[model samples]
Each structure stands twice: as C-alpha cells, then as structure tokens.
Target: MNTKKKSTSRIMLDYLFRFKFYIFLAVLASIPVSIISASPAYIVQKLLDKVLIAGNNNYLLIIVVGLPILFLLKGIFYFIQNYLMAYVGQKLIISIRYDVFSHLQKVSLSFFSKKTTGQLISRMTNDVNMVQAMVKGSMTILNDIISLICLFGYIFYLHWKLTLLVFVVLPFIGGIVRKFSKKIRRVGHDMQEKMADVTSVMHEAISGVQITRAFTMEEHEIERFHNKDRESMKAQLRGVRVQSTVLPVVEFMNTMGLAIVMFYGGQIVINGELTTGQLIGFLAGLGMTFSPIKRLTNINSVIQQSLAAADRIFSLMDEDIEEGEEDKNIEIDDLKGSVEFEDVFFSYDDKYDVIRGLDLKVRPGEIVAFVGPSGGGKSTIVSLIPRFYTPYKGEIRVDGKNINDINIKSLRKHMAIVPQDTILFTGTIKENISYGNPEATDEEIIEAAKMANAHNFISDFRKGYETQVGERGAMLSGGQKQRIAIARALLRNAKILILDEATSALDSESEALVQDALENLMEEKTTFVIAHRLSTIRKADKICVIDDGRIVQLGTHDQLMEKGGEYRQIYNAQFYFLDEASGE
Candidate 1:
C-alpha cells in the first residue's frame, strides 16, 4: 500500500533475463541490420563521385544493382530483430501478470479489507499494459544504439578530427536527458497513484449506486469523481509536457552538431586534405548517428513510466502471506462433529483482545445458539471455527484433533457458513445453488433449494432454475437473497453449519419459511447459530449468553429463563414487545 520507493533497475534486468535468449537473438540480429543500413550512406557517396560526377557508366550500373540488394537485406534483418524483441516483451508481460494474480490469491482476507477493488484492478490492468508498452517500445532505442556504434566507428576511421567535433555535443544531450528523466519519473509515479485513486472512486460509485440514489447523493458522488479525474488529468499532462521537451532538445543539439560538421568538413576539402566523396560520406554518417541519439533520448520517459508501474506491482507481490506450514494436509474421515474451545483468545491487533479466555464444548450433533449484545464477539467466535483467524492462545479441537494441525482446506470442506450479508455471483439460479457443491446433481440441487424454502419462488420465475441473478443478485430482494444463500449452504451438505443472523434480513413470512427450512436442515447435524433476536433462537437446544468476550451463562432456553440471568432479561424484553404488539 506504500508508494515510498521507486522500482530498481535491477528488478527490470531480472525480468528481462526471463526472456534472455530472445533478447540476445534480437540484439544479435540488430548487428547485421545496422551494418547493412550504414552501407547505403557509404554507397551513395561512392556513386555520386564514380557515376554522376565522373560519368562512369559501367560503375553506375554496378552501384545501382548493389544498392537495392543492400536495402533488401537491411529490411529482412530489421523485421526479424523487431519481431523477436516484440515476442520477448510480450512474454515478459505475461510472466509478470501471472505472478501477480497467483500472489493475490494467496494473500489474506485482511489485505483485501484494507484495499479497494478498483485500486487492485488498476494495478492488474492499466499498470501491466504500461510495462508492456515500455518493454516493446524501447526496442527502437536498442536498434538505434547498434546503428550509432557502427556508424561512429566507421566515421572515426575516415576522419577522427571531424568526429570529435560532432561528439562534443553528446555530453550536453546526455546531461539534459538525465535531468528530464528524473523529473519524468517523479511525474509518472504521481500519475499512476492518481490513476489508481480515480479507479477506486469509479469502482466504489458503481458498486454502491443504489445507496447513493437512496440517499440523494448523486451530485455529491459525481463531484467526488470529477475531483479524482481532475487530479489524474493534471498529473498526466505534466508527464506529457516533460516528455514532449525531450525530442526537441535532442534535435537542437543535433542541428548544432550538423552545422559544425559542414563548416569544418568544407574547410578540409578546400585545403585539398580530403576528397569530396570522403567529405560527403562523413556528413551522411553524421546524419545517421543523430537518429539513434534522438530515439534513445525520447525513450527515457516511457522507460521511467514503466518502472513506476513495476514498482507498484512488485510491492503487492512482496507482501508477506499468512504464515502456515507449507504442503501440510489435515486428514479427517467420518468426523463426529465434536468441537471444543479451551482458553481461546483472539484479536485483530495485539493491543486489544476481542475474544478472551473463552472456553466451550459441543457434543456431536448438538445445536448451540449464541446470544449477546452488539460487539460481544459472537460472530468472531463462529469465524474462528473455519480458521478465518487463528486463536492467539489456547487450542480449538475438532473431533479431538487440534484444528491448526488439520488441513485447512479439508477442515473447511466439512463446514458451511451463511453470514448476515448474503453474497451471490452473477449466474443462473441453478448455478448459484449448485455453487455450494459444484459437482452436485440437478436432483440434489432441487432438494437443497426445497429445504431452504427457495424452490417455490424460483419455480415462479419464468426461467425457473435458469433464472439469471444480476450482479451480486441485485435483482433479488433481501429476503430472497438470504433464502438463496441458505440454499447454497444446504446444498453443500456439510457435517457442521454456522448461521450468523441468517434470517435477520427476511420479512415475517419469509422468516417463517426460512426458519422452518433451517429446522429441517439442522436435523442430525451440528449447528452453531448467532442471532440478535432472542425469539428466533428460543427453540435452540442450548443457549449460551456471551458478554464481554466470555460466556456468562449456558443452559436450555427455559432453564436460562427460569434462572433470570442475561438470557432472562433478553427474553423478557422481546416477549413484552411481542405481547404489547398483540395487545395481550
């Protein structure tokens, strides 16, 4: 999440090494292409003197034939080199994208909670594309370098004096480009960050559009989006301005170099120290050299931008994953569903514990209901059962084996959880129900849906089981979403079930239907229920009253009512409210 550091060149070098063979081939191919391309300038000088100036007809024919041949070879080598370099660049992008995606999957849920989906999506999409452009687009600079070295070497062999004059401008151009690059890199980093902010805002607004409309906040949301957009635009414009200056500055130095070459070369020819052909050849090679210099100078901005994107991507990949023994598998066959918590304690942060020194036990097939005031760690207790978080101290045993030692994947396979908020992906009704068990047969899915009391409503839809659920099932009402979620859990047919305020969102009629379905599903299975409504859980086999992260009382609902403890007070409040409503 921190953007304090820039991506190192060493990392880019390492990534390039992934396709080293292709890069080497591309670089090597540039050698032949450079030699062929440089030959045309030298050939033009010879033809001007031998054919046009001297009127040598025989020599002119040979030069004409050879010129076309040289160009043909140059084109062939250029194509091969460019294509291979492009291939390598594409391969490198693919490698980085795959590693990022795989790493994200292994990251903890806490990482997701702290970051926005839009920010993460921007890193995956826009950032990766920038890196691809940098890699592929920079190959021209490499080709330019090859051509420059060849041309310069030949020019020095012909006349070192004039070459030195032309080379004098090189240091100044290098310094200017270096200065421009530093500022461009800073701007690029800022632009990428601002772009991420824009993406985050768009994602939030789109996902929460209903809430915005309900609160009449459309204007405010649009203004917030515009602000993020304006910031991103400013940063991008600054980058463009810096990049636009690079080429013109290179061209200015190149013009000065050319003027110096023509003046000095003319004097040498006038003094009879150099032939007209040699002077022309020198000037032609000088022109060729500037092309590479200009290209390399212009490529600096794009390279810096890519490095900025790489920095953001690598930072995410470098985050530490939740620590656990690798390749360890927990084996449990025919579990009896006995669960025990001994002196369990947990906290999101070390400084404050949410569940402290908790101890409880449930026998096989027992139905236990947890009742507590808000923030009493009731949901947190159920979350621990599926290893959403590990206890800071003490041990939780399932069927007499420590849960940590059990294979996390296998342990979760035997449990199903329905949270207060129901989540359904975009799919058909049948697909959503069968998601609990992807391999479930059509008959099994229908049975589970019937048990959840969702079959009737689904059958009424024109599409029936094929009915499409919009994004996150937005088309479904709150009660319908809850029923479908319960059906999903029921389809899993796990040995243990945890329902956290599952019926809280349902209307009275929907609640009765879902509660009946729940009662049926609880038969012969271990169930842990967390509910704020005392009436809904009164029929639970045992009610555990939790207060301040500890169980203050545990008994049958009638026993707790008779004892007049925390459970009694909760029951009296709910019972009186219901009685007053009915005018009893």
Candidate 2:
C-alpha cells in the first residue's frame, strides 16, 4: 500500500481535471469573448481619432457597423464558454456524488451506527452542491482573469502611466478579500451544520409521526423544527452580512482607483500630452479590467466556502471500511444447518459486552427458542449468524466449519431472518414477496404469499400482486407488512431461519395467522426463535433461558418447568393471567 497522502485541493482537482477536453474548449471559447470585450474601446478610439478628428466618412461607417458585429461574436463565444464550463462543473459533481454514495454503501454497519442518516444525507447533497457552485465560480474566475489580462494589454498600449495608477488599490482589495474569505468560510460551515440539524429533526419527526400524534406532541415537534430552522437562518444571515460587506469595500477601492486615473488622465488630455480618443479608450479598458478584479476578489470567498464543504466530504470518504471475514475464501453451497457459537463475546461498543462468553449449538432441522429480557443480546446473537456483526472473541461454526472461513455472501444465502420490525421497500406486492429471491417467477411469488397466508388479502386489492406498498410498506397494516416479510423469507427457501418476535406486535388474529405461516416456513429449516411471550415457544425442541448475556438454563418446556428455575419464573410471569382465568 502506498502511504503517500494527497492534499485536499489535489483530490478535488482530480475530479475536475478528468474533463480536460471540456475545460480546454471552455477556455478557448473564452479567448474570443475576451478579445471582443476589449474591441469596443479600440473601435471608439478609431471613431474619435480618424472620423471626428480627420473628418473621415469611412471610419464612421466602420464604427457603426463594426460595434454590432463584434457584440454578436461576443455573444456566441460567451454562450459556448458558459455551456462548456457548466457542463464540466455538473459532470464533476455527478462523479463526486457517485463516489460518495458508493463508498457509503461499502462502509461497515459500525460506521452507520456512529453517524446519523441526516448527516450522511447532508454530506451527499448540500456539500456536493456547494462544491458544484465553486466549480462554476472557478470557471467564471478563470474567464474574468483572462479578460482582465486582455483589457490591460489594450490599456497599457494606449497609456502605460495611467494604467499603472489604475491598479493602486489592488493591494487593499487583496487584504480585504483575504479577511472576508475567512469569515465566509466560518459562517458557511456553521450554516451547513445548522442545516444538518434541521435535516435530522425532520427525519425524526417524520419517522415518528405516529408516536408524536399519539402523545399530542405535534406542537412540540413544530417548535423543534422551528428552532433548527431559526438557527440555519441566523447562520445564513451571518454569511450574508460577511459577503455583503466584502463587495462594497472592494467596489469602493476600485472606484477610488478609477477616480485617480481619471483625474491624472484629464490633465494630460488638457495639456495636449494625450489625444481625447486615447484617454477615452484607456479609461474604457481600465474600467473593464477592474470589474473582473473585483469579481475575482469576491470569488475568493466562494472558493473558501467550497473548500470547507470539500473538507467535510473528503473526511467522510476517508473513513475506514469494516474489514473482517473477507480474507476467508471458503464457500458453503449446501449447508447442513447445524450452527454453534463457541464462547462468543461481542459488543456494539468496545466499552461493554452485550454477548459475553456465550455458547450454543443447534442441530439440523431443530427448533431452538431464546427467551430473555430486553437488551439481553437475543437479537445480537441471531445477527451474528448472518455476519451482520462479528464476535470480538471465539468463533461461530456452521456444520463443523468456522463461519469466518465461509464466504459471507454464501453463508448468508443459506439463512433468512425475519426481524421484529419488518422493513418492506416501496414496490409492488409481487416485488416485496420476491425481495429475497429476485429470480422467483410470478407463480413462485404467489406460492410464497400463499404459504405466508398473505395471498387472500393481496388478491383482494385492486391491483392484486402488482399493488404498491408505499415507502417502507406504509400503505399496509402491521400484520400485512409482517406477512409480506415472511413471504419474502419463505421465498428464499434457506436452510437456516431466524424469527425475532414475529408475532409479538400482532393482535390475536394476526398472531394466529402469522404463527401458522411460521409453522409451515420452519417445517424443515434449522430455526432460532427469539420470543418475549413464553406461550409461543412452549413446544420448542429446546428452550434456552438467557440472562446477563449468558444462557443460564437449557431444556424443553416441561423439563424447565419441572426444574423450577429462571425459565419457570419467566414462563409463570408471562402465563400467570392464563392460569388465573382458568382458575389454576
């Protein structure tokens, strides 16, 4: 691996520099516009010197016809310059955005755990947009610089002394621009942060609208959004205040320089030291020159703002992706579905272990149930089997082969997990059912839906299998979403299955339907069921009572009840009402 570090400017330029042909064309197109821009002054010089002073009809006619023709050419070149430069800027933004999004997809889940979705969204959208603006501004600055040089070349030829005087305020303009650039950059960063806060608040409020309305917190949420919006406004105002101040100061200095040049040049014209035409042409060129200088100074602030955004974007890109298990070359095609966790220790954060020295084993086609209090690592244990996370110590094996030795994709291909919160994408019912098996035929999708007890309700919809499930399945009820999720997993036809409280959130009728579907789905698969309701797992081949990240008791339902341990206590606590109703 090369250890050489690249500068931020170099990294950003690499993207822009890729389209050298487009940039070259833009620059070449700008040249004619720059020359044409300076031509009017020279044309007026001829009109005044040769026509008015010499009483020449030829010079007058040329001036009348030439001015419009020159402007027309300028317009054509200007259009080409603008179009090509904008094309390059937009292309650069597209490439950068693609890189950022692709990198995000490859980064480990831990990276996401450490950062909010809103922050990531802000980086991909707002930061890239700022960079886009800077790229366009850069092209404008380049064009202005070229135009300034051409204008100066003309003015110096007419009067070198007066041209020197016109640049008197250049040092002062530079100082003011440097000072203001810092303020603009500082405020730009603050504004971006405030906008990110607003994004986060919006995401939270939108995602939790149900809870907010249920708890009568609509007004509170409105106030929360308002506070974030106000902060963003304040930051924008500060940036505006800084930007607004710089332009006036720059204009004042340019005006001062223009005044000195006019006062000095007038004396020369009066003393017959210079011609009236020469003075007029020199003044015109000087004015054109200073306009670009002022804009370039302002452009410095824009560049600073873009650099701040680039810093944020590049920092995100530099994050280390999760690395483990990829080096393992073993491939598992026909897994026997026997899974074992041998003294596993794992944690989301290194500070505390959520799964500590835990061990478990399940044979092929066996149904094992995990019963634990909330946060007892039940879900984490199941997540490990699919390589969503890796244990800090010890090893997990499937069919006597270390899981880390198996290709992650191949390992996961043999397993399917139906989480408590069923996440369905915004697509047709057929798409959702075949999510796990994209190659599934229409007939197979229907079969999977039927197996999950979802066919009847789906067929009742106007569009049937093609009916759209709104974002995250918002168009469907909780029971319907869970049923679709089961249908998705069933379509996979994996050797190993995990059911994490699949029926916990459902009503009695939904639970009955889902439970029946689950029974069919788990018929020949090695199943791990994490259940909060003890009654649901009473007939499991093995019930493991987990406490404080360890399996404290392992036995069948009748054996655990007879043993009278933690399992019995949990079973009694959950079913005590049923016993009371039956007068037990």
Candidate 3:
C-alpha cells in the first residue's frame, strides 16, 4: 500500500472524521454549557432590575433556586464535554502510536539505518503527546467559539451598536496573532529539534556507558549532555518569549475595547436611552464573550506547536515501506534451501557497490562458508538471502523460485539467524528459548537447550529454566547469552541457518562449546556461515573467499590452500604469521 504524504490539516482532519461520532456528542454537550454560561449575566441583570431596584422579593426565589439549577446543569454538561473530548484525544493518540510502531515493522532495515533510535522514540512519545495536546486545544477552541457566539447573541440583543464596536478591535488582534504565528512555529520547531538532539545524546551516553567508563570519559559525556541541555533550554526560552508577547497584546486590545464600550454605554444610561439593567447585562455578556476569545487567542501558539509536531508524525507515516512483489503472492513454508545468487549487484550507496555481480549456488543441505576481510561484503550476502535488502541489479532464488516472488513472511519463516551480537529480552530462560517457537513443549525447549550446550549451565542456576535474564540478557555471561540465542534458533528448527561470525568475540573455551553446538545444529540444514576466524571454516563443504565485493577464490579449504590464492594468503596471515609473532 503506497501512502502519499498528507498535509497537517488533512492528517488532523482524518482523525477528526474517524471519530466524528464522539466529536459530535462532545459538540452537542458544549451547546447547553454555552447557553447556561450566558445565563449568569441574564440572571444578574434580572436580580438588579427586579429585586434591587424594583424591591421585588419575587425575583429572589428565581435567583436562589433557578441559578443553582442552571449551575448544576452547566457543570454536568461541562463534564460530558470534557470527558468526550478527552476520550477522543486519548483514542486518537493510541491509534496513531500503534500505526507508527506497526508501520516501522513493515519498513525495510534501511529506514532504521537512516533514523536514530532516540529520534524515532521522540516521534512516538513526544510527537504523539504533542498531537494529544493539539487535539485538546482544538476542542477547546471550538467550544470557546460556541460559548463566544452564545454570549455575543445575548450582548447584541441588549445593545447591537456596542456589539459592533467590540468586533471593531478584533481585526487588530487577529492581525497581531497572524504576525507572531510564523515566528512562534519556527521557535517551536527549533525546540523540538533541540529536544530530539538531547534525547539522542542521552541514548548514546547510556548505551555507550561501558566504553565511556573504560576510557575514563564520563566527564566528556556529561559536558556533551550539558551542551545539548543548554541548547534545548535556549530554544524553549525563545518559544516562550514569542508566546508571551501574544496574550498581552491581545489582552491590551480587549481592555481598550471594553473601556470604550463602558464609557459609551454609561453615557447612554445617563441619557435615559438605556436601562441600567440592559447596560450591565451587555457589559456582563461582553466580558463573558472576551474570556473565550482570549483563550482562543492563546491557543494559537499551541496550535502552531502541534502543527509542527503533526508535520513530523505525518512525514514518518508517509515513509515508504518494503513493498511486496507486484501481484506475486507465492507462499512457502518448508523450503529445500538450495540457495543461489545470480549476477547480484548491490550498493548501500549507489556510488560504491557492496556486492558486485556476485554469483553462487549451494545445493540442498550444503554447508557453505563465506570468508572475507571486514569490508568485503560477506555479511551483505547473508543479509540479502532474507531480503533484508534488495539487490540493485540481480536475482536471488531458493529451490529455483525467485525470492522476490515469495511472500516475505513465508520466506523468513524457514530461516533462522544467530547474529554476531546476541540480543535477548528481559525474560526467563525458558521464555527466551521459546521465543521463536512459542508453542514448544517444556521437554522440547529443554532438548533444544541441551543441543545448544546451554542446558547444563542453565540447570546449575537455582531457578533452572525460570531464571530471569535481565534487560538484553544482561544478567548472563557472553557465552551464556550466545548459547541461549543458539537455543532459540535450535527451537525454530528452520530449514536454513545463518551464523554470522557467531564465535568471533568468545574466549577459546566458549568458542569450543559454541562450535560443538554449531556442528550439531548444522547437521542436515543448508547453512551459510560468515567466518571471521580462519580456523572455523576448514571443514566446510565449500569455502568462498570474498574480496573487493566479489568472490576471488572458491573451493574447500584444502583446495584453496593448494591453489595458492587470496584464501591461502588469509589463512597464513592468521595461522602462520600470528603464531610466529606470538612466539617472538
């Protein structure tokens, strides 16, 4: 589904229309509240004219009883209005947040690479929250307008001439609002950007805390955060400055208009052209009208801020996700895993190709290993197998079927990946192991753990399978975490396995245990191993030595060693030269 970019107004209007029923009820609730709000002025006018001046005790009963009834009804309707608006605001926020997060899952990995975690987090949290406030402000402005209209109707009934004069100064106030609106929006955008920066800095500091402490650079991180904090503070202050000028200017205009009305209306009363009750009632209605008007004016700044936030949120919602192949809906469950890459050309940046015209084939159940220097596109090849990225100009196939024709979810279901960096959620060991195959029985989970060589150590703990591994499995040692990850993959029992430099960072003892688990896991599945250590892939069925984004040597390790090519050079560099240097 292609989502065209939406304007801020259109996006807001979409949500408004989606929940129109609630909005309608809320608007309906505001009508009575607005009518009752104007009642106070009318009641006061009646009390003055009939009770005080006329000395009519008959008006006292209405004042004492009718006013309370109106007040009670006003309170009830106001609660309805407030509750419905809040309900709409909260509903919109939750729906949008869900869409944003779900949309992110459907997008390609390229999107994540381009966006920082903190920036995305801010979009979900800060941006969504800002939109919530915007919704409330919009509802407030609507209700205020309704209230203002009701008050205006009463005032005009009392004195149409004075009502016209009150409207005279409104143009000037609106002009002032228009003049400051762009500047306020600019400041608000800056403030949001600076806050995102602060969030990014905090994320980096927290994630890299170990590195910072190891290098004794805590003060450096603190100073960096301080700079971002100060920038955010300055941006907020600028927004505040622009917003502060708006209300005062609006209030001053209102005061001047009120003074003119008071003087002219008082003169009319003295000339016996108007009754004191009418004059006071008009003034009371005028005061009520301007209160909402003032609130409406202040809401302008909040509206601008929300529009800025809305723009960002809509932009994110419009980002292009990885689309499925056009009209191709082939479903695959159990794959034969006869993988092949034909004339594949790929590039992270178009200028520099990462996988250049690469070609390879692995027979079903073959154990193929890719060995290469750091930048030689080894990881890129395995990543392409699952369509994490698409080739610039080539085709990838599994069992003679073009990968692009396969449903992405169905294709991925047959493959399991244990990456170099193992990530585990905060959960019990049993939960982590059963992450991939959630329906696995306890016996099956323990069997998979045993196959991964994780069962012994796991049982050593008092809680066994129920032991909690803290955030990202922080409570577990590196080898323990890696084994758990492998156990998860083992439980998946996928037809194709991708081991990406799995044992590169482990100690010798841990590497041996992980290698034993790997040997067992690779028994019958077609495996693609990305080997960093030269010793690991010696027994692989086929070894492809990659360099400069192309395979330069292809053979078994023994064949490559005998061929005296790039493969032999790498092997000697790691085995012979490294051993000799250590001896020295």
Best by lDDT: 3
Model 1 residue runs over 4 Å out of place are: 1-40, 58-91, 327-329, 460-464, 502-505, 532-536, 569-584
Relative to the unseen true structure, what is the C-alpha lDDT of residue 256 in candidate 2, on a scale of 0 to 100? 91
> Deviation in angstroms for 352 in model 1?
2.3
The residue-by-residue lDDT of candidate 2 on 1-584, one tens digit each, is: 11127666888778877999999998898888878876777887887889988899988987888788888989999999899988988898888888888777766677888888788788888889999889889877877877888888888888888888876678788888888888888888888888888888988899899999999999999999999999999998988888889898888888898899899999989999789988988888777776788778778778888888888888777875545555878888788899999999998888999898988889999999998677788888888888778888999999999887787778889998888889999899998888889999999999999999999999999999999999999999999998899999999999999988654467878877887887888889999999754455775888988888899999898898899989878877776676577464
Model 2 clash number: 0
Per-residue error (Å), model 1, residue 567: 3.5
Tens digit of per-residue lDDT, candidate 1, span 314-355: 888877565473655767767889999999999886778889
What ranges in model 3 sit over 4 Å off?
1-3, 503-505, 577-584
lDDT string for model 3 (1-584, tens) is 22365568877888778899999998998888878876778887888889888988888987898888888998999999999999999999998888888888888888889888888888888978988998899878877887788888888888888789998998999899999988887887788888888888999899889899999999999999999999999999999999998888899999999999999999989998778988888888888877887788788899898888877877787877777655669988668889999999999877999999999999988888898788899999999999999998989999899988898888888999989899899899999999979999999999999999999999999999999999889899999998999999999999999988664477878887887887778889999999764445765899999998899999997898899978888877766664465463
**Local distance difference test values of all predictions, in order:** 0.84, 0.85, 0.87
Scored by lDDT, model 3 comes in at 0.87
Give, for candidate 1, the lowest lDDT window spanning 10 residues: 1-10
Candidate 2 — worst ten consecutive residues by lDDT sum? 1-10
TM-score: model 2 vs. ground truth:
0.93
Identify the runs in model 2 with alpha carbons over 4 angstroms from their true place. 1-5, 324-326, 503-505, 533-536, 578-584
For each candidate, what TM-score against the reference?
0.89, 0.93, 0.95
TM-score (C-alpha) between model 3 and the true structure: 0.95
